[model samples]
Target: MRRTTFIESYGATCKNWTWSWSFVNKTQRFVIFGAWQEDSHHIAGRHLILDEHWATRIPKGSTKARRQPGYPQAIEHLSRVAEEGYALFTFPIWQASVGKTGAGRDPSSIGRFEPRLTPKTLVHEGGMWWAQDLSVVALHSEPDVQDDLADVGAPELGRDEGHSKPTGPGHYFPRDRKVREDVLKKSGEKCERKGCSEQLRYKSFLDVHHILGIAKSDRVTNCVALCPNCHRDAHYSPNKDALNKQLHAYARKRPSN
Candidate 1:
C-alpha cells in the first residue's frame, strides 16, 4: 500500500480539492474502500485511478476516460509516492445537484452510514451489466415503479402470432461481390460440365448448383460450378440423370492439368 493524491475540480467555484490517497502498484490483492457523500460534486464523475503496474477492478459502466500525453507523467509521479509504502484508502463525494441542499446532517435525526453496494450486488446476481445497474438506481428513486404503473395503454406482452407475408426479391444469400471468388478458386475457374474446357470469366454467368438441390446440403462434394447454358441443360434436358452420369464420367477421365 502507498499514498497517492488525486485532485478533482469543482465547476461552480473553479476550485480543486485533493480527493483521495490510494495504494497503486503491482501488488495483486487490493480493496477499494470509500464512503459515499450525498452532496459532494466529485461523485458524479468519480473513478479509481491506477498506474500501468496496478490492475484496476472497475465496476461495470465505468470506462477509462480520454487522457492527454501528460497522463503517463502523472502516473510516474504517483508511482514515486507509492514507493514509501503505506496503506491506501479512497473517499468519493458526490457534488449535489443545482439548488440541492448542501452536505450536512439534518438537525433532528441521527445519520446512518451504509455501504454503496448496489452495483456490485447486481453484478454477482447474474444480471445483464447495464440494464441491472440501471434498474437498481431507478428503484432507489422509486420513479421507475411509478412510471410503469401509469402506463395503462402499453401493448400486451408476447401476443403476436400472425404470419408475415413475403416481400419482393428476398435473397437466400448475397449474390454480388466476392461470392464466387472462393467457389471459382476451388473449382479451378472451369465449368464442372465434362469435356467443357471453357474458362469462367464472369461469375454472374455462373451459378453454384447443388447436386442434391437441398439448400442445407451445401458441402463442397455436393456442389459444382456450372455455366448458365450447362446449368439450364441439367434441369430442363429430357434425360437429366443419364446426362449427369455422362458428365461425371467425362470429368473423371480428364486430368486436372
Candidate 2:
C-alpha cells in the first residue's frame, strides 16, 4: 500500500497563499508537487516526484479560480478518502515572496503606501528585497493510491465513531498543573453550593462537578467544586435552593476562628 496526501492554499482579498511538497530520502531532498494562488482567480505551480531511478515533474499552469478545487475541496476530499483507510499527509508550505501591489504595479514605485516587503522577492532584480508569506500544498502518492486510501480511512473511522477517550480528569488538568491547582485553590477547598462551603477543607472532601453532566465536556466554565454532601444534594434535592440553604446553615454554625 502506498501513502498519499493532498494540500492547498487559498487567496484572500489582499494576500495569496502558496503550497509546496517536499520529503527526504537517504539525505536527498525531493519536491513532489506544489500549488499556489498567484492572483484572485488563478492557481499555478509545479511539483516533482522522484522514483527509485528517475524523477517526474508535474507542471501545473494557471487554472480558473473555482471554489471546487481550492483548499476547501482538498480538505473535504482528503478527509473523506482518509476515513476509508488511506495513508495521506497534507501540510502547509511557508515560502518567501515579494510584496507587490494587488494591481501588479512596479515593485520600485511607492505609490501612496511605503514599501511592504516579504521574505520572497517581489522583483528578481539584483537589489530588490523579499519577505516571507507565500504558502503551498504538496500531495504525495505511493505506488498504489488505493493502499494510501486505506491507511488514512481506517484511523478516520475510529475518530468519527467517537471511540477516542481522554485518560485524565479535566482536559486542562492533564496538561496544565497550574490551571488545576488554581481552580482548586480558588474554590476554597469547598463545594460551591451557595451554602455548602463549610464541608470542604481537604481535597478528599471535594469533587469537581460539571453542572450539565459529562455529556457536555466542551462546556468548561460550567464546572465547579463541590463537597460530597453538597454534590449529592445538588442532584437529589427536590429544590436546587435546598443546597444553598444547607451551605448557609453550615456557615452560621462555624466559629469565627
Candidate 3:
C-alpha cells in the first residue's frame, strides 16, 4: 500500500506556534494544529483533541473578529478531508451569529483541525453547524485513531449551563435572523416551493417561511425558502392549505442533517 505522509511530513516542524507565522506563512492550504493559553502553553501529541475551552483561543482571520471569507472554502475543503480520513489544523476565530434574517454567513470552526464533516443535529429544528466538537491533532501521542470519526452520529444541540429562558416555549422574537440564514444556506438559497424560481435580488429577498406555522413549530424541517409572493400565499391566500401541505411534504422529504 502507498503510505500517506501529509501529517507525518509536518511532524518535525509542528510546535507551539502562533497563527501569523505558522498558519499565514503556508503557501498551500493547511490544517489548524492546536493552540495555547496565557499560562499553560504546550503541544502534547500528534492527533489528540484539545478540550472545548481552547476553542475561543483560535486565531482571528478577519477584522472585528467577524466571519472570515475563507470559512465556506474551508468547509468544502474539509468535508473532503474528513471523507479522506484526515483532520484539519489551524487556530479558531470569531463566528458572527445569524438566525431568522437569513442574512449572514455559514458558521465554520476557526481553530486548528476541523472534523472534515462534523456531526450535525438531525432531529432538532435548527441545522446548527457546531464549532466545538472538532478534534485537535496536538493532544494525543498514540498511533493514528483519526479514522475513529467514521461512525460519529448526530448529537443533541446541548445548551451550555446558565442558559436563560427569557419566556416560556416559543415566546422569543419571530424574525429569527440566525436560524433562517442557516436554513437558506442549507437549502442552497433556491426556492424550496417545488417549481418556483425566485427572482434574484441584490440581497436575499426570499423569506424563510415557516411551513408548519411559527406558532406550531419553528424547527428547520418545518421551514422553506420562498419568494415574497409565495411567502404571502403560504399564509393568507385562499389556497394556503394546499400550498402549505406541499411545503410540509417537501421539507420532511429532504434530509436536514
Candidate 4:
C-alpha cells in the first residue's frame, strides 16, 4: 500500500506532501512513524536483533522553531505505547526522484517496531524529549518481503561498532543466573504454592518464577518454584498481580536457606 493509504488505514491523516512523521490516531491509541533508512538516521547493526531509528538530534521544546509541530503529539503517542505496552508501526522511507514531484523521501514499505523504555531509545534530557533509539524488529514490503536489517540503501549502517545489544530501563536490574539455579534446586522439585500437591519428576518441570519480575534482583528470596499450572496462573491469570503478591509473601516468609 502507498504511504497515504497505509497511514489513513490506521485512522491518521498525512499533512506533509514531501516527507513527514507522526500519523497518530488518538482514538485508536497507536502511532505510525516514517522510519528513514539513511545511514545518518538509522542503525541496522549486526550485533543487535533490533534496528535503531533516530530522530534528527536537535534541541527540542525550548524554542518554537526547535519543537517540530508534530513532535509533541507523536512523542505522546509513542510514550503511551511504551507505558501501556502497545506496538508502534514504522514505514521504511527514503529519498527518491519522481517525475512530477522532483526528489524527496517517501515511505515505500512498512514494519513492526517494539517500544522500549531504555534511556537510549526514549528519554527526557535537559527538559526536552529525545527519540534516538526507536527499535525496529523487521521490515515488510507489500509482497511479504521481510528484511531483518532494513538496510536496503545504507550498507554501512550495519558496521560492527554502530550498534550494541539493547539495555533495560533505568529501574531494571540484572538478575543472577546462579540465584535462579539455587532457588529452583532448593524447592525440592515441587510446586511451592501452599496446599498445592504438584510434583516434578525433573528439575526442569518446575519453573523458577520471579515474584517481582526479572527487573528486580534474582535472589533466592525473590524467586519461587512452581509447577507449569501455577506458573501459568502467576503470569496469565486474571488476578496475576494478586497471585504475584501472594507468591512474594510466601517467598518472604519461607527461610532463604
Candidate 5:
C-alpha cells in the first residue's frame, strides 16, 4: 500500500495523525507497522510492537507504575482481534526516523499474518500486550499452530512468573475463513435472507453471520452469509433472536457443499 493510503487509513481509525506501531481498523482488522527502534530494542521475537505508551518497564500490577493511558484499550483490542480471527497486515520500515519520507522499506516480506496464539508466555505482562511469533500463513489455513517455528525461540516459560495462561472460557475462538468462504459460496453470492433479494456487487462481499455465536464454533452449520443490511438486522433488529433462529435453521438445511 502507498504511504499516503496507509496514513489516510490509519488516521481514520486513530485520532493521531501519525501512525503508531499497531492499530485495528473499524472492521477489527489489525494494521501493524514494523519499526527500526523495535529491532534495536532486542524485543526477543518477531513481535508486533505497540505504541511506546504501553512500553513501561515497570512490571504490571505495580502500584508505583500504573497502567499507561492506552494500555487497557490495547489489551482489549488484542483480545477482540484475536478472538474474531481478524487479519493483521504488516509494513516493514527500515529506519528509526518516522519523519523520513522513504525510510528503508522492504517490499518482499509484506503480507497478511495471523498471531500464533501458542506463545509460551502470557500475552499480557509488564503493562504490555503484543502479538509475538507471527507467520505468513494462508488466510484460509487452520487456526493457530504456526507453520514456521524453525526461527521462533521456545517460550521463555520461566522468565516471567506473573504471566499466566489465558484463563476463562471463550478465550481463543478464531473465526475460520474456510468456513466463512464456504457459507458465502453456499449462499450463491446472494443474501441468504428469506425475502431479501440482495446480490453480490462489484468489489462487495457478504458478511458471514454466526447464528450460534462465533465463540462456540466457526463451522458452516453455525454460520450464514448475509448482506450488510441483513447482517445488521440479524444483530440489531428487535426480533433478532427470531432472525438468528431462522438463519440457523436455514444454515442447517443447506448442503455442506
Candidate 6:
C-alpha cells in the first residue's frame, strides 16, 4: 500500500524541509541528508503539472514534480505543522507503477526545469514528478474523477450491456436504458444500418442512435438501433448527409404501435 506524509510549505520559514535516503545502490550504500523541495517546489527548473489522463505525470518531468521518496517515510501526529493554505503530501512509490497519459515531452527535452515558474499538483521525487490532487477535482470526486481521464472515444468495458462510460453529450445519444431497449427491440435484435448483419451483442455494440441527431431530437421515433461501427460513422463520417437520410427513412418505415 502507498503511504502519505502531509507537509506544510510556506514562502519564508518552512521553505527548506529535509529528507534522507539510505540503501545499497548500484554504486554503494550511503546516507545523504539535504533540504528537499516539497510539492509546489521543484528540484531546480522542472515544473510539476498534473496530466488529466489517468491523473498522473506521464510527461517525463512528473517524477521531479511530486518529489516522492523510494522508501516508506512517516510523520508523527504531534509534529503537525500549521499553515494558512496549500499542504504538500509526500509518499513512497514503486516507480514502475507510474501511469503514462500521452506522448510526453517530445524528443530530448527531459529533466530541465525553469527556475521562475512554480509547480502545481506534481513535485519531483526521485528525479520525477507525480500527480497529486487534480486541479478540476473536488466537485467530481474519486471514480467520477477518473472518468475525466479516459478518452472521449474510448470503448466501453461491458460492450454487451449498458454504456457505463461518459459519451460526449452533444455528439452521442444519452444512455437512457429504456430508450436503448426500445430501439434494440424495434430492430429485431439486429443492426439497423443497411448491409450490416451484425446482431445486437450487448447494450453497447447496439447503440441507440438519434436519426435527427443527439443534440437535437428528444422524440423516441427519431432514435434507432445501430452497430458500434455504423453508429460511430453516423456521427463522425464526412458523408453523414446521405447516411442520416438512410437511417431516418429506415426508422420511419416501421408502423406505429
Ranking by TM-score: 4, 5, 6, 3, 1, 2
Model 4 agreement with the true structure over 143-166: per-residue lDDT tens digits = 011111121223344422222443
What are the Cα lDDT values of the candidates?
0.33, 0.29, 0.39, 0.47, 0.47, 0.37
Residue 115's lDDT in candidate 5: 30
* Maximum-TM-score candidate: 4
Local accuracy of candidate 1 as per-residue lDDT tens digits, 1-257: 11122211111111111232222333422222233344331122222233232222222254553322323433332323222221223334343343343222121111332223222111101111100223222223221111111111122321121123223321112222232344456667777877764676653445554443321233344445666556655655676666556654543344441
Q: lDDT tens digits, residues 1-257, model 5?
A: 45545545554244332323344566545544343224543254434344334433343344454333343444444544433334444444444234332222221122333231132111233333334434322111121211111112222332123134334321332345577678768989889989995997732346677675442455788777777667667755788779888888888999753
Candidate 1 positional error at 160, Å: 42
What would you estimate as the lDDT of candidate 4?
Answer: 0.47
In candidate 1 the C-alpha lDDT for residue 223 amounts to 47
Q: What's model 3's TM-score?
A: 0.32
- The residue-level lDDT of candidate 2 at 210 comes to 39
Q: Give every collision pair in model 5.
A: none
Root-mean-square deviation of every model: 23.9, 21.2, 17.5, 13.8, 16.8, 20.5
Q: Give, for candidate 2, the lowest lDDT window spanning 10 residues.
A: 121-130
Candidate 1, residue 200: Cα displacement in angstroms equals 1.3
lDDT of residue 76 for candidate 2: 31
- TM-score of every prediction relative to native: 0.28, 0.25, 0.32, 0.38, 0.35, 0.35
Q: Give the Cα RMSD of candidate 3.
A: 17.5
TM-score between candidate 5 and the true structure = 0.35
Model 1 regions lying over 4 Å from their true place: 1-169, 174-182, 246-257
Poorly placed runs, candidate 3 (over 4 Å): 1-175
- Report the error of model 2 at residue 3, Å: 34
- The deviation in Å at residue 193 for candidate 5 is 0.9
Candidate 1 vs candidate 6: the TM-score winner is 6
